[model samples]
Target: LVHILSHSGLLLLRAGVQGLSYAYLTALVFLHISREGKRVSLPRALLTPVPSVPSPRRYMCSLSLFHYSEYLVTAINNPRSLSLDSFLLNHSFEYNLAALSSWVEFTLEKLLFPELKQITWLSTVGLLMVVFGDCLRKAAMLTAGSNFNHIVQNEKSDTHTLVTSGVYGWFRHPSYVGWFYWSIGTQVLLCNPICMVGYALVSWRFFRERVEEEEITLIHFFGEEYLEYKRKVPSGLPFIKGVKVEL
Candidate 1:
């Protein structure tokens, strides 16, 4: 009974956090598109096409590759980002079941996997990782401000330059690194041993693929400048002082 109540409360908390984040992002996207006007097409601007402009065919070709790559990466990372509303309206019992299935992960990890559920320093470390990592992730976004985006943007229009200082100084993609640890830490804090492994493996692959794609896009956009920055900075981590990956 206590376990059920606790899980229920955690689910509600997760829902609340996701709802607030979605609302905030919606508001930010609306404001940005409203101000950008025609350079970025309406609604379609979400996909980021510049069809209204005359034939700068070469630029368009590069942009088309960029936009599609960004879209694919977003879809891969967040399969529901663009279509959650339609899903909400059409959801059925199965959908609710799927939503509630998180408890199964919780149960399996906390109950069946004693190796994972044991109390250890990892619990404290995981707690700190979630808290500090989340804060750092937010700070990276806020620091970059409007320049921050899930989609790669043409640097020509953004108000900020390549973020090579601050969080950027910490790692080339500090936000991704923060999120990577933050996610792994979630399973640790939850005492879900199986999920800790799953999270670590899954997030590593996702981020590795995503990071590689992003660097390609960055090199395309920033040329030698980004290459130089890449050399100077390690690839976003608390691997920070000691380790560096030259992605």
Candidate 2:
């Protein structure tokens, strides 16, 4: 940041410092939230008030929610299988790439063309996407209970059952639906046009493949039951039709 300041100006320095601090604080909050010694019930934890984060920092809030919700929701629904990896927000290489790209685009745009970064309305829309997407994903996880897995299950377990109630009734892959929007939303929050487009395309392709792969296993597990559910509920992602079935 100091080096950037030498080349740029005090404002850039301030932005860099602020960004780092926000990230650091978010990590701290997560560590505190997920401390090994203390475990709180999901309901109580949900009721706990989170401190209000400022405008741009809401991006951090959304990110934090994205990570911690995965852990928390799974802990509630699939406690026996819960692990740190459940915090999928921080672990994916693709996720890190997307985040880095957003920061890079924001920084370059901020430096080269400051006025381009002032899209307040766009940021607002992005924040809405983040909130809605995150909430919807969490809801699907909750609805699925033990049925949800961060990884697609190739073999059905004794406890694994088809989920077709609640959010599942509305969308065959509500979790993926939520994630697809959230992935794109993060880039929008940063006002990174390039990352926004890239995130959307990448996320859509990834989910498209994932839903198809998972559906094959679902059919194997539940056959007509799964096919019937598929017929009724849309995949809920734009332009994704899941595995093509000849019926």
Candidate 3:
């Protein structure tokens, strides 16, 4: 009886961990899909002023994980009927192979650390920082990108009014701020010293690029109005100035 209970407990723990992993994976995918759909559906005028609506498909897909969890539970309950190793491998192969390539690479590297003794905590932290920073930066970029329409060929640029509400009210580039925090947080959480240097370099490069691009575009479209606004408001960091302009 004790042996049977011990085996059951171990199986339960494995099933729980596997289910949690799938839930997280599903949520991340759903979020990405939703963001993409919102970007596609946004109107040019409203892109500047309001939040975009994510797609229904993302919600539906995320909810489908419950069905997957049920299957995992059933499989766990009938260990003799199902080859657990083969079942897990097959299910993961089908569900996560393409969708989680980066995660797989990271996991493999960690798993093989015993063979590669040089892999220190600092290195892991650094990797985590870069990953987190990039993710945050991308999220902010998408948020800003969805709201602004880029006109590539027009010599005479057009500004779609000033955006001083929502995240814009705090920082001229909320996306950059988000990215900065993400990179820092990731590095700290992962405790990777090597990742910190890489994160710093990556953060600086992207920050400069994004700031220049945004400022140039704003200047071209808004002209003196944007210049004056820049002077009044601190660029990059969020420090709201009491300056108001009639756009």
Best by lDDT: 2
Stretches off by above 4 angstroms in model 2 are 1-55
RMSD in order of candidates: 19.2, 11.9, 19.6
Better of 1 and 2 by TM-score: 2
Model 1 agreement with the true structure over 97-189: per-residue lDDT tens digits? 432443467666546675654465565555566656655765666566555666555455535467776787877887788777866766555
* Candidate 2 vs candidate 3, TM-score winner: 2
Cα-based lDDT for every prediction: 0.53, 0.75, 0.43
TM-score per candidate, chains pooled = 0.54, 0.78, 0.40
Backbone clash pairs for candidate 2 read none
How high a TM-score does candidate 3 get?
0.40
Ranked candidates, highest TM-score first: 2, 1, 3
Candidate 1 colliding pairs, count: 1
- Assess the local accuracy of residue 155 in candidate 1 as a C-alpha lDDT between 0 and 100: 51
Clashes of 2: 0
Clashes of 3: 10
